[model samples]
Target chain A: MASLIACPHCGPRPKEEFTVRGDAGITRPAPDAGEDAWYAYVYLRDNPRGRHREHWHHTSGCRRWLVVERDTMTHTIYTVADASAEGETA
Target chain B: MADFALLHRPALADAKSGSFGAPSTVKRITLAALPEGHVLHVLAARGSGDLQGLIPRIGDGTPHAARPYGPGQWFVIGDAPLSSAEIFGKTPILDGKASISDQGHGRVRIGINGAAVETVLAKGTAVDLALSNFPVGHSAMTLIGHISALLSRTGKESFELLVLRGFAESLWDELIQMSLEFGVDAHTGK
Candidate 1:
């Protein structure tokens, strides 16, 4: 149960409206990068047990994509931000 | 409507006189189709134009509610369909590069009334519907079941919901089911 996530626009709502978009910190490999880089970028992932940053889509409401920082094990959402403009509001 | 022989049928074509519970029950929740209205999805963001000028204040001295479901975005609803270009004809905004999309036919609006309306809504949505919290003229985007729904409180005991055209029937069914525990009075017309 993902409880509630506060959407900067619609306020706190049930998480059902969102579809987790996965880790937000990963950078895509360069187009010219070798196969090893592409392999790592596409296959490798750090399953951090503690604090994690991920992207979530508010599919049902504002349709705004957001980045959420949370404690993986505790499922405590520390903060959120607009995915399109990470430096701005959550 | 992209060319086939589109059937002019209402979503709930077979709702029948199927109503559950009695009007004398604890509280009555009435669900019905709202009078036809126009909806505009306004994307008036950081670089967008001043949307405040588009939706004017009504006779009550209160401005018509612009539902801001996203940051810097609003959905302006009116009794008659009003397109952005039609409303703003020759005038153009230099500041706000606001984008407006007409959702007149792509969305469905339903009205929920009666004293038990709040109770029925509370069963699915998390927003506080208390009179002090979500009073009349208040509107917010929230989910009812898995569907994204824009809830606007029209009165103390009445609310209107806007959802995608495809999900109207499902949402309507869900609302009726939720109202079952309480009391639901269904009718074909207002």
Candidate 2:
């Protein structure tokens, strides 16, 4: 697991302060979308091994939603940005 | 009406006090429970731009009166208690750009100071407490040993912690434990 996350607002902090929400790429399906689409949107997720973007909440710090791009295997963080700034917060 | 009235009590009334750990003079840490003063939480209205210049208008004109913990959020503190009307009176200072919520009854301040204050705080938090990285008057909302608290630098060797009322004692204990090596004198009065 990534040991530290450089919060865009609070700077570098230990990962223990954040709560991971997993898979920032997923989008909410429209209410009228098909059942399969809704099911996939609600429950399906990709367990990628390489670079991935995930939603993490700085629960104990600045309390901001951040999008963290990092590698699952190497645990090297590539980028950390405010989720709202990227227009990606759900 | 109920038979009993709600009695107000200080958060750390029963907290641990006195000295502990290795005896030392140069590295001794002083832990004090600051006065139960007014703590006002301010939040910027949506789309409100930088309030760096306007927020101080609500402060009590004391040094470090306005402490910003996050973007668009701040805690205006003072040593004097305030009434609800007094708190609301400062609303117009923001001119509708921000709102204030009274946190006086919910939060409390703890003062810790010593030559090794940074070293003791470092054991619990990851923030760089060096004077260069965290200058005086800078505040950061971070976890200190699983407890959420706002840490603020006040002087070369002194720092203050603003924590929720329910967790003040726990954090106090943890702070003492962290300073055991340097010896600590805790005063949980007033």
Winning candidate number (DockQ) = 2
Alpha carbon lDDT of each predicted model: 0.73, 0.94
**Cα error of candidate 2 at position B5, Å:** 4.9
Candidate 2 wrong stretches, greater than 4 Å = B1-5
- Please give each candidate's TM-score: 0.82, 0.96
Candidate 1, residue B157: Cα displacement in angstroms equals: 1.3
Clashes of each: 7, 0
The candidate that wins on lDDT is 2
Model 1 clash pairs? Answer: A81-A90, B47-B97, B48-B96, B48-B97, B48-B98, B49-B96, B49-B98
| lDDT of candidate model 1 versus the reference | 0.73
Looking at model 1, residue B77 earns an lDDT score of 68
Per-residue lDDT of model 1, residues B82-107, tens digit only: 54456454134314456556776777
Worst 10 residues of 1 chain B by lDDT: B55-64
Can you tell me the DockQ of model 1?
0.74
Which residue pairs does candidate 2 place in steric collision?
Answer: none
